[model samples]
Target: MILHILDEEKFLKKAIQIFNDILPKDNVYLIGVNNKKSEIFHERIQLDNMFYVETGSSRYKRVFQEYAERADIIFFHNLYKSYKLNLYSLIPNNTKNVWYLWGAEIYGLNPRINNILPLTQKAYNSNLPLLKLLRKRVLSKIKKNYEWHLFKKILTNKIDYVLTNISEDIDLLESYIPNGTSKGWFTYFSFSEQNFEDRIVLKRNNILIGNSSSETNNHIDTFELIRGKDISQRKVYVPLSYGDEEYKRVVISEGRRLFKDKMVPLTEFLHLDEYNSIINGCSILIMNHKRQQAFNTIMMAIAAGCKVFLRDENTIYSCLKREGFLVFSVQKDFGGEDAMNPLTEKEMLRNISLCQQLYKYSTVKSRIKQQILSILDEQDKT
Candidate 1:
């Protein structure tokens, strides 16, 4: 049996539902969400996302503990409350713990703010709301306090493995929890679940800037980056459906101030069909995230025959390029004379072929199953 200690994110609900269906029986669960209380979903709904829902957090704790006791393994998804999770004292020593490393927990915990372009960082810092800034400061202090407290013991003694596609994430994590968990790859974002028809590739000229209004997406910097590029015919689309609302306003204002008529801020969420249609029309998807974010969008961009650009500082950039993805670097590749040029016919065709072959649903299914089974196999052996 398994118990997943989840952080409430909308994507995780859909992802876990698919994971539950893929795995045997109802063992995998998207735990810790009370649907009625969730920001993403309202009402006392019996969605498959959570197994046990209760109004009282005390009851939720009891439920969590019950499942945890029966669990052969416990997965800490994203390390949202890593130091505060009471990891060492809570779970049985025999039970394996895996940190499903979402980029945020690491970057959000200890960010490389300097890695971002000056303009965006300034915009984010300047535009950040006072309440959020205070909250950020409090979190920063909490992170420091944890460094000398329980994190080391928990990471080294309790957590057995770090599950993520990027080893560089592990490297960064080690800087915090040194000689901690062993790292392994998980294809959570692998393209296998995608539909064949959705990737309607065209000789497009429109551009997609970033995945969200989050400061990390560097929307403000992106506007500055493409300030004088030959994009008169191209309309820039920025997804701002979620993330810091205050930052979203900043991004929207900055984007419009620079690009004016060309800037299109997606303030509302769109259906997948509608989203894919937008991507299909675009020939370029430029994600300037300083970390591994917007992977789903980037992968979809590849399938849509869009030329992708990423910051070289981001580990995924090297990983993508090494894995045969035609990812360009915004640092060196963009800010050039031919910056707006779409991928050539040969490059586009190759990217599509690779995307289809590697990220096909079957491949994703196999990859996830294999990863899951590997841990189960270890359990069996022990």
Candidate 2:
């Protein structure tokens, strides 16, 4: 089968792995939207037929039109508002268009202003617990928006299928797209074989935190707000994309002064091998977004046996909780109102203990891989 994949950043690695593993015997073609050099490198490493199209947004519609006619299926990974999948509108109706909703795409904008504004006004008028009400409002909005968007898109589009890494994700998607079937898939954003053995040995020293994309600005803000508040020792590492110097400067000036020796910034993109090394070397992974999106950084930490901390009440958090993973925290007290909140020291220790337990039993990689294989087999029969 001819498959055309379009995406940005490192997610292409996972898509390529899944395509090769599940459809090894079938004819497959890999295509990248931008970064022609990286696409060429990716093609060199794999035996399957691969091609790269470094077309800008202005030309994508025209380019995709030609490619779509020749291909049987089109797969989009990490596609958002910018690299609009509306280009799929150009694809021939007979060619299947598959959207792999990894995480944030399912959940709309952070804080979900549409849902939170009313709750904020209500909380102001009423004398209810403000933080608790806010949390409820925020979570409710995420669930409602996630369902609305996924359902709307699935019903409106000519999409043949929706694929995700976690089974719980399938549940969330099916809640909206009742006709949608689960296509089991996993990401290949883990430690390389050379470092796998070393990663298994858990370390309890300074916590290592990193962020690469702009979507994580909320997380950066929360960590800045809590900096030097008696949490576990932290060493922040940021891999800034090209022309992100302004963001880096602002984060450094307003937040905790990152130790110059510990800071890691990327002015240009690095290959997957180098990126893996930096991610594998980290200890704990931290994500503090109001809406807990499915981030590969957290997954990489889990694969490397590192503790991951995120907001507790979001859909992703709820899904992880059901799976027996304890890697989340809900913000209850921000200011003097809840000053008597639990100390960060105690919470950090508790989180560490839970991390150990989760690492012992969770093999997310294997479960996800099996699901992807099953989905592909079923798709083949159809």
Candidate 3:
């Protein structure tokens, strides 16, 4: 039997649905870790297939002890050690353990030395108090180091398989993962298909900047990039759905100051369909992320036949470029091309074809299932 230990989150419900459809109800068991924001998720998603347990509770530990022997495979969503459960005790030696590398898990594993200080102008150059910023910096460092230690001890040596697609993350996994730990290309819900039929290519005019309020988005840098441009008529959309609240406020203030009425900060949570509909209207998507973030959103934009601008330094840009996707770099001026320039019919069709080939839902679903089966087959062989 397969056992999945996931944190309770609304976003994960979609992934759970995919799992339920792929595997038989009797074969797959779901356990949720209770966390700070998990209660509401638990209340909303009431499923017979899932059991909610507080990681700190003795009963939770008992459940883990029982399941550790029963489960043939134990899949961890992310190797985040929370007050919810002790990971070392829960993971069994006999069972095959698989860790799904959500971007954050890998991204934060090896943070840059420059970004270690929260007070660094690179990460947090806000107008907050000096003492508070220092405290935040110290606390952040302690937490990251502790998590790194736990990761090395509990997961790096024990996991049998890791699921990821990013080239950078693969390198990181190779650098840290112990021998006998296999890696597979299974990106988490990042790909979606585009219908080539009746494709309407949007003009690369209006700007959509950044994915979230996270410091990695480099909202300050992106805003600074287009600060001098005359965006009086063009609408700029910035999604700050869920991240650092203080950063969100700062971004909003800066955005308003620069673009005034043209600035649109999407602070409230949006349904996928609703967000996609809005994406259709947008033309240019500029992501100044220092790390991999908003991959799903970026793919969605590409699917919608929008011009995507990312730093060449980013893995996504290089990977997509290698795969024949026509993405541009924010650093280079795109041969002095204006962002407001409209794409030709040929260019639009090319983008649509590429998006369909790379990010289609059907393709993504098949790959995910195949990867899972492949891992199982390897286990059987062993």
Give lDDT: candidate 2, residue 136: 51
Question: Candidate 2 local accuracy as lDDT?
Answer: 0.50
Over 4 Å off, model 1: 26-30, 34-37, 41-49, 52-56, 81-88, 111-115, 128-153, 192-200
What does candidate 3's lDDT look like per residue over 117-231, in tens digits? 2322543556656786887678877877777667766655678887766766666555664446777766555445434447574444577888877767877777777777767
Per-candidate TM vs. native? Answer: 0.87, 0.63, 0.88
Which is better, 2 or 3, measured by lDDT? 3
In what order do the candidates fall by TM-score, top score first? 3, 1, 2
Summarize candidate 1's per-residue lDDT along 1-382 as a digit string, tens digits.
Answer: 7777764555665456546756756364635554564544322235543564442366666666677787877877766454335545666777778778777666654533344567887887776778877776697677646644565566677788888777777787777657746677665555644554454555688999898778888877778788878779989999898877888988989889888989999987787778888888888888898877877888878877888999988877877787788879998989778778888877887877787777776777777677777887897788
The RMSD of every model to the true structure, in order and in angstroms, is 3.3, 9.0, 3.1
Q: Can you tell me which runs of candidate 2 are displaced by over 4 Å?
A: 25-32, 35-48, 56-63, 70-72, 81-84, 108-155, 167-186, 189-204, 213-215, 230-234, 242-245, 256-283, 292-294, 330-382
In model 3, the runs with Cα more than 4 Å from the true position are 26-35, 38-43, 55-59, 81-85, 111-123, 176-180, 190-196, 199-204, 340-342
Which candidate would rank higher by TM-score, 2 or 3? Answer: 3
